[model samples]
Target: MLVLSLSTVAFLGLAQLADASGSPSTGHRRRTAGGGQAMNLVRSAPNSNEWSTQQWGHWAKTQKSSLEAKYGGAGASGTGVQKRATGTNYMTNQNGDSSYFGSLAIGTPPVSYNVILDTGSADLWLAGSDCTTGCSGVATFDPSSSSTFRNESSPFSITYGSGQAAGFLSQDVVQMAGFEVQNQIFAVCEQVSGGLLTAPVSGLLGLAFQTIASSRAPPFWETLVTEGAWDEPVMAFQLTRYLNVSGVQTLEPGGSFSMGFANSSLYTGDIDYVNLPVTGSYWVLPITSISVQNQSISPPSGQQAYAAIDTGTTLVGGPSSYIAQIFQQIPGSAPGTGDFESYYTYPCDTDVTVALSFGGRTWSISPADFRLARLTQRECLGAFFEIDSGGSSAPSWIVGDTFLKNVYSVFRYSPASVGFANLSAVALAQNGDASGAVPSATIGSSAARVSATGSMLPKAHRSAGIKIGCGLLYATSASLLITIAVAGVHSVLL
Candidate 1:
């Protein structure tokens, strides 16, 4: 399992500034250009977290579309225009057989091998068979055997807050739906370790739109948009844990990822969109504030930072100090005493309210979502905040399902502007809950639905780990060793 670490907090913090104040001239605006709302592309710095001076110029040179356009509306045999396919099938791997994969087709030959569909990551990756791996469960793609394979050895690596994976860059002919694209830039992990290999997927297919793609390549989703394969550059997802269990499923061919649009019924029409500031090459956003129970807390002043809004992360993470302050406000939240500083807990039954103040809006999380998991009695709740020894100074945060459950988020990026739309409660109700939990089916399949049931971790294991860690830490401390030993003895006697 990927040990979701605290280092991601800095990245999240940087992305929160998507709407920070900036000059209209310097930021992306929804303007009528080229007869339509042309998306203005912003490039991140060459080797830093800031946006670079080269904006549209760099994108124009590097951007590749996955679709081809036809003139007019082409019928089955007519010469009218038809749009090329831009999306691909995302899959899951179970045991060792591709047929047993979760969301993908059982018998379809993979157009692109070693593909990964990850909720905890924003970019897709594939490994060519030639790469290196000392670990197990790694799949390799034989590009030569596939008629749609293309290689572009750009050499890439993505370092998460918890660990790092390196691989070579290559392009291959990829097919999904009715679309076929040649030479797409994808990464291959040559050496991967630290439990990430255990995931049931071969590689990563990031669902987050292009805005947050790693610097090595253009986002796969954005590549399709730029090619005019899509009418708009927008994508939306309602992920339910159990429903997504198999992982090899694909969206219906004509279904909309719904780029640049919001389902108004899910939330209030009050949309908070921000212009990203160009700080070097990276597009950076500033987080103004964070809160718990609707009470706002001040962040480090004058430290203008940028972050990427990532859908791949499971929890909101940031710098230790910043995270510490945020968690401090929660009534029963506490730090872990283990080698991994990324674990936290709280009373299961506590009615907690956690909110993030960003882009002039307060995004709140309810008690049900804040509680990591329920105990055997289904009465106690566990806290979800994690601290990382690696993220002591970086100002980043990953806003995952914990907070997204209460809102309907839409991500859009075109030449005109890149922003998100929040929908109203009506839409949310129709889509079920935003929390990605599996619903109990007291009824039959027709009435089955996803429901919130707290965190993924089992309560018993959590409690045991906490007890053991606390016992060890307390027993080793000079001031508490004797006292803890005495308490242990006394407890045994009682």
Candidate 2:
């Protein structure tokens, strides 16, 4: 994520004004041209634009070094931990208009805006008063009266997997979890094109590293860091699937946003860190090999594709060629007869495993993770199609919840490393110590059973043709269990 210096002159002017009369100004030096001071009178003028530009250049270098030291070195070797806790929470309704779903009573009653937690792209934007009928059931964020609102009128636009939106920039007093983010720069999309307006979500809360943010705007994460609200420079997440019926839509204020160092007891061993390519502004993880059902398939050479470890995306997407090769490996897999390009279908009950190799580690995914949920019966549908051939040339993959549920994922932006720890290993290590260990139970109508002894050894669990290795043992019921294992450390069940 190379951050190009935007306008050297503009930055220099700002820095000069900020440092005026503060110190002796000892380090400030004049630039010489042709082995002589170019226009000695102008060059010596401290407030001249050229003089300020030189000062800015010196300060910019210092700022970069300071930022690196505070955040971490550039690329995957840097280390930082998320200041907040990470855990799974449920949405209340599917109708996309609810902005404030849950409320938190702090100095004033704070509302938990129904924000789409996205990791694919970095930007924290919400709907403003300019939003009209697009929001059906959600509350709109009105910035007109906020004392902190700063209307820049800067034009902004964002395109997503489904659609795009264009709007103007404005500053507002944004509050979350009792924390006030003052004069935060946000986008107010007056008009949105794409069906996203109809989804159950109201706005998007980007949680990705600040490196991959809109070129025109500073990211919400950066604002938080600049405000000194958090001590750590990293953030972590743990997403759970198939919560109890009563737990669905459980959006109460101050619920939980778990983040901390990886729990050692939750995994069988230490977490593995892998290096990735940091080119341009994206972090690209090279795929050493991709296999299905244990058979390896070769992808096009010199065609390195970067994948964003996105928790918001529900399905995995990648280059069409790569996806085709993967689906071809499945015994009964075939292309769908429709406009969809890379979509393929296989026998409903066929057992398959998709394995992806990255950074010397091979992470295998279960068929259930690849299967799409059908509108009826709630059964596994099929593998998600990756459409990368059209206007989109970037061979990127968005690894969603299906693949994430099996591992505990640690997203350390400070070091730019993604760590995976298998959940099965964690569950078995803590089976029954009166510390919320998972119990042996059966999930689904199938006769599959999950047995854990609460130890660091591996345990097996089977349900509906899906076989999982449980490592961490915490709590269990008829269909689900709170177990921990490596891959990061996650609770797993049906």
The candidate scoring highest on lDDT is 2
lDDT for each residue of candidate 2 in 167-219, tens digit (9 for 90 to 100): 66565544332233434455566655323332223355444444444422344
Q: How do the predictions measure up, each by TM-score?
A: 0.55, 0.59
lDDT of 1 by residue, 405-489 (tens): 4555455554322244454444344221223221100100100011111111222322111100000000001111110000000
| lDDT values for all models | 0.31, 0.35
Clashes of each: 84, 48
CA-only RMSD, every prediction = 19.5, 23.3
Candidate 1 Cα misplacement greater than 4 A, ranges: 1-123, 130-139, 153-167, 176-180, 206-215, 241-270, 278-284, 304-307, 339-343, 374-395, 415-494
- Number of clashes in model 2? 48
